[model samples]
Target chain A: MESKNDELLEISNLETLDNYLSNMDNSKSNSYISKIPEVCKEYPCCLGIDEAGRGPVLGPMVYGISFCPVNEGSLLVELNCEDSKVLNEKKRDDIFVDICKHSNKIGWAVEVISPNKICNSMLGRSKYSLNQVSMDSAIGLIKAAINGGVKIEHIFVDTVGPADKYQAYLKNLFPKYKITVENKADSKYPIVSAASICAKVVRDHALQTWKCKEGHEYTFKEFGSGYPADPVTKKFLADNVDVVFGFPQLVRFSWSTASNILKDEAYHVEWEDIENEAPSPISNSTITSFFKMTNQKSEKPLNTFFSDRYLSRKVDL
Target chain B: MAIHIQSGKNDIQTNPKFSNNIHSMPFKIHADCDAQISKYFLQTPIEKEILSASFRGHPLLGKEIQIPAGYRGVVLHETMKPATEKEDRKFYVIHTFDKFKYWNWEKAPSKNDPLVQAMDWIDIAEALHSPVVEE
Candidate 1:
């Protein structure tokens, strides 16, 4: 049965969904949000940040922010914005609509980090670790809110990594705002709960409507919530994977699940040393060893022609 | 001596000091080249060495990388002959396949270039217009 949330998302249109994916360059990132709420200048606004879909192997990871006057925590509670994981999709969608209706009182935003973007960022040569990437996204959202003329005072965050470290990092970044980073701050703080709802809802919409190009065969029934642990999703991954080209664009190639799946099914060949000529002590093989040739014969310094810079010979996998 | 020899065939494989690092072609590239390279690698055959892989300038690797034939071109140092004297050339030494292979090129091999028969890097030669290694 199609849930009201899916119906509201209008995800059934494959062209619309594929167009959204096509808007961003492959391996590039983008975001989506409801209109930013106009903050009451007289009241000190409190902002809460939370992320959803961090664990899922498919779909984009979403970061959400919810903000309102510090005194208006009751507004969120009255709207039934509690721990989103416990809330039904209909209930969350209802709460999201209410939040939208009361835009002046409540402001929210969501950043959808595509699987391709995640793969690109994580696997790129510079190697911005996932944690760092998450932090950057959170920080960017906060900065955007403040820059957009929101008077943010106290910040609450739900963290997956070390809370203390995350808090310290945020504090360092925004010295003017009081920051609290804790595991499951979503349950403790109404604003965070609202953010969690926003995140979850957006993620659902994204996943439900996910599409690649026109010709590729795709059906929503095959992919579940995109969690690695889900059998349905795993089955989808296992079934849909093209050994040569890999799973469709939705799958994060950098994820061990996807890569591991490919390795298991595909006929991968790696180059290995057929014969070990020098039984040099394994400990002695450093990058410098290439330069420190024991049997020095020619005076040529091996400068531009070639440099023996690869240290792969040290450890045989 | 302008030409120096640094041989890593034995040391890289056996040295316990570098045991923690799993050295292979670090599959990272610039955003611009990523889609093209990935498309080629994923859709194409593995043994079909022509245009197997490509990369931007890397510290441990080469600058403006193209794989297999280009790798062989760098180490062997004679795989590519420039079509014109005005063409600029660059080179790099990278670790791969149990040893450091040299890679350098002035231009990618043309589709009908006689060298394409012997080397596959020519397939991607047009795609990669920049240096694989930086100074």
Candidate 2:
């Protein structure tokens, strides 16, 4: 019932983004790519990469890539694409909608890295830093674009850490293309601005439509901006501290803001080591008897056999 | 107050319920939290028998344990609360299980675990109580 352009217009709409996100498990990272622009497939195109929500303690971080014909760089400026941080949410949404209208010239993709995935990668036994996660997302997006048949020749990226190191790393990975990693590429380059808008719009919509996997019904307004500095976010973190689970999956548990709150408020959970530690000089019996003296009224002394296995008898279900 | 376990008349015999894919987290949560377990708590087979899953952010290793022959596990549900102090609270046997996976935080579930050691006691108790034959 709808024309191709009309369908493409829905790409920036709230309902469509919500539908796409709701269908997938938000606990894991997900990727979405636009249909390759017909012109982009035939002509040599310049691609740009940027991200949004990187520092947020809540919601997903989005890595976005936008590509257009090499000569159409000015067209992005004409569409009012600019640094997403400077533009308000409404202005970014408008520019994204305008970009969608010219779908024949530009194509874009976004990788939505969920909060749970971020926390898992950072806090897991083998620590994976946030910078590594960002780099992987950027690399993944570029690969997705190239694989989708966008004949990209030049690539621009908004840097995560040291720009020179990131530029060298990307250059090493993608030897064929001209890659530029700059501090404020979103402000300097129109293509990077377009990418920033795409990423920002997707991230904003993700926060708006977020359904807590842990089944806590919370409005987005309740936790403002997802920044550790925001008072609302701090209050939300403080108010929702669970004795055992700490916080819901909506939070990035690896964030010092959330972890600090848990350290102060939540119950202490001790994880035993896989490899046995050397026994204490005081002896196990001495410690057991000491605990028995203090816990005489509340608990029965566990047998030596059961204690060796770290078993405690349950009095109730 | 006393508690009474009620065995209801629903006699549908199903396979032993095993939490094969669930992560047995170390800590317990008191709040009534619900989740789409199948969607979120996915387990990957790390080796031939060892399984791995993520809980919160921590990695969990797990393995299935079968109850010794002739032993069964039951899952009970509380059905009613007593109206008066004189009456007892009631719980019903909702289902039964024979084998369930046990998980350890970042450690493999093995014979050294408390649950596994507890199960070992069943065999020991049986051997100890059995009649001895004099040669």
Best by DockQ: 2
Specify the poorest-scoring 10-residue window by lDDT in model 2 chain A. Answer: A1-10
Fnat of every candidate, listed in order: 0.00, 0.29
Off by over 4 Å in 1: A1-26, A213-215, A269-317, B1-135
Tens-digit per-residue lDDT, A121-153, candidate 2: 886666789999999999999999999999989
Which CAPRI category fits model 2?
A: incorrect
Q: Which stretches of candidate 2 lie over 4 Å from their true place?
A: A1-12, A274-317, B1-54, B61-64, B72-100, B106-135
* Cα-based TM-score, every candidate: 0.60, 0.72
The CA lDDT at A63 in model 1 is: 93
DockQ of 1: 0.04
- How well does model 2 score by local distance difference test? 0.81
